[model samples]
Target: MKKRSIIGLTMGGLMLIAALCTKAVTPTLRLSDTRPKIILGTAIPTKFGDWQEDASQVAAVVNPTTVAELNKIYAETLSRTYVNRQGNRIMLSIAYGTDQRDNLSVHFPEGCYGGQGFAVGQTSQVVLPTVAGGIATSRTVATLNSRVEPITYWVVVGDKAVPNSWEVKKVKLAYALQGMIPDATLMRVSSIGEDIEQGYQLQQSFIDQLLQSMPPDLRGHFSGTSH
Candidate 1:
């Protein structure tokens, strides 16, 4: 065969294989449908352990996502303030989307805070205590005016709790390559306080208590553990 003709044939074959692979791996099944319906209202308890949801402070907690973004990104978003007997309050926000395709995933707190004129600090890795030992997470501090907020959050890609944004994308792509679209959730817990260390400790304790209050399976669901 002529060299030009051979090169052209090779290119054509490669393009055909690429198209076939793309079609073969196109995700048509949502992993969420394989499980029971998710109802944020009941999936996360209103009152757990010594903490109870306080309606008054719920409004005080601001969601990082705006109304339009919230509607676009999440199928259900839950935001609440829980107060303990000691009057300590922690604001919990959860964003869950049944479909997390390549074009969309979840919003970052740093972006929202930056847009709102708040100074966001460097994020540090942390582990949230759970029955399965500990789940990897991230923490950062955001400040606006005199208010200081310390946040501890994690992103779950399907049944896996990813360590960072890069891992999130990797997991999503793996699922997509398997012809499955994975559901994802972003859970954030924060408290307004100047003492960042103390704030993190309190948040950790709250998470431990909250997880302990749920069933083992539910605990696994929240932490993305096999427990």
Candidate 2:
């Protein structure tokens, strides 16, 4: 009986120590935990070429008037996160009716290792493509990425509403930028480039097309104009 009791006590003690050690091994923050899914947001690993290309192409087709307006109206962005096996991170930022102040932005920062983030920093200027002197212009300030934890995103929307149904325009891009971050030289290029403003110009064009497609009656709602 004495020998059996000693064995039982030893087993119990070992089990308790093992449990405590297991708890200590667990990460404090578990940065590896998958980020929450957002309605209009998605994350893609860097290896996938189509991901960045598709996004840039979309931005190219849709044009916003000015860099400011482009930033405000439409931008699918990812920040502070590296690419996983899938593709570059992607998130859509759009206002429902015309509420700019209470906008929502999604961030996927979990998988970033290094050299992963917004292609253009806050200071960088992105000039959108343009056909000519066209639609109205407006500006709003917003952030797309943050260096801290939990990831951060800034989606800017103004009190602008779309009048008609959603209009999608597919414009052929002579050149387009893939991934959120561009190379060093591209970053320095002006929004009003010698011929084209890489990121800004293309996105602006689509914004204009989207606005024009809106039903003539609904146009006023997004422009913050009353007919």
Candidate 3:
């Protein structure tokens, strides 16, 4: 009986120590509180390269997410429509959240469009070339009746950018392991057209120009800094 008691006590002590270690290493630091805040309105230009804000079409680029839900999850959201010299218009939506831990993950366009009765197509991955390097992003098509929308998007966690929705959680966990909770930004650009290929080309052009237009640090915020 004495030997059994000693073994039981040792096991209990080991479990207690393990729990304490876990509690100690668990992330409590919030990088959002220290990092510079992203102001969506000014971060993206209203005019860059050959494109300018199509103010008349801005009202059409509405998010399916309700205002209350957006307020609960996002720190800031920007929605606009821009037209290039060729009259091609692209809808831009950006959502930034200070904390992506728990239920605050940025609402992806795939889910938002699904909620709005659009049939979402398979998503394709693309790597956009930038001065900082290549930014991995996802492109997909959503169709509803006569309207077909092709969207390209990426998520920025801390200084890292990821295109996959599942990868966002991985990035968050990596940050948590370092005892820091990283902020996240979701930037989506879509255009209404049946020719998905052409739509994507226009979007890539707009995105490249838009990133180039921003100051280096601001550009780094979205595409990351490491060349």
Best by TM-score: 1
Task: Give each model's whole-structure lDDT.
Answer: 0.86, 0.27, 0.87
CA shift of 94, model 3, Å: 0.4
Clashing pairs in 3: none
Local distance difference test, candidate 1? 0.86
lDDT of 2: 0.27
True-vs-predicted CA distance for residue 109, candidate 1, Å: 1.7
Worst 10 residues of 1 by lDDT: 218-227
| TM-score for each predicted model, relative to the true structure | 0.92, 0.25, 0.90
Deviation in Å, model 3, residue 189 alpha carbon: 0.6
The alpha-carbon root-mean-square deviation between model 2 and the true structure, to one decimal in Å, is 20.1
Question: 38-122 in candidate 1: lDDT tens per residue?
Answer: 7888989989888999988888676776798789888999999999998889999988999998666887777777888989999
The C-alpha stretches of model 2 lying farther than 4 A from their native spots are: 1-92, 97-120, 123-196
Residue 141 shift from truth in candidate 2, angstroms: 12
lDDT of 3 at 207: 87
Cα error of candidate 3 at position 175, Å: 0.8
- How many collisions between residues are there in candidate 1? 0
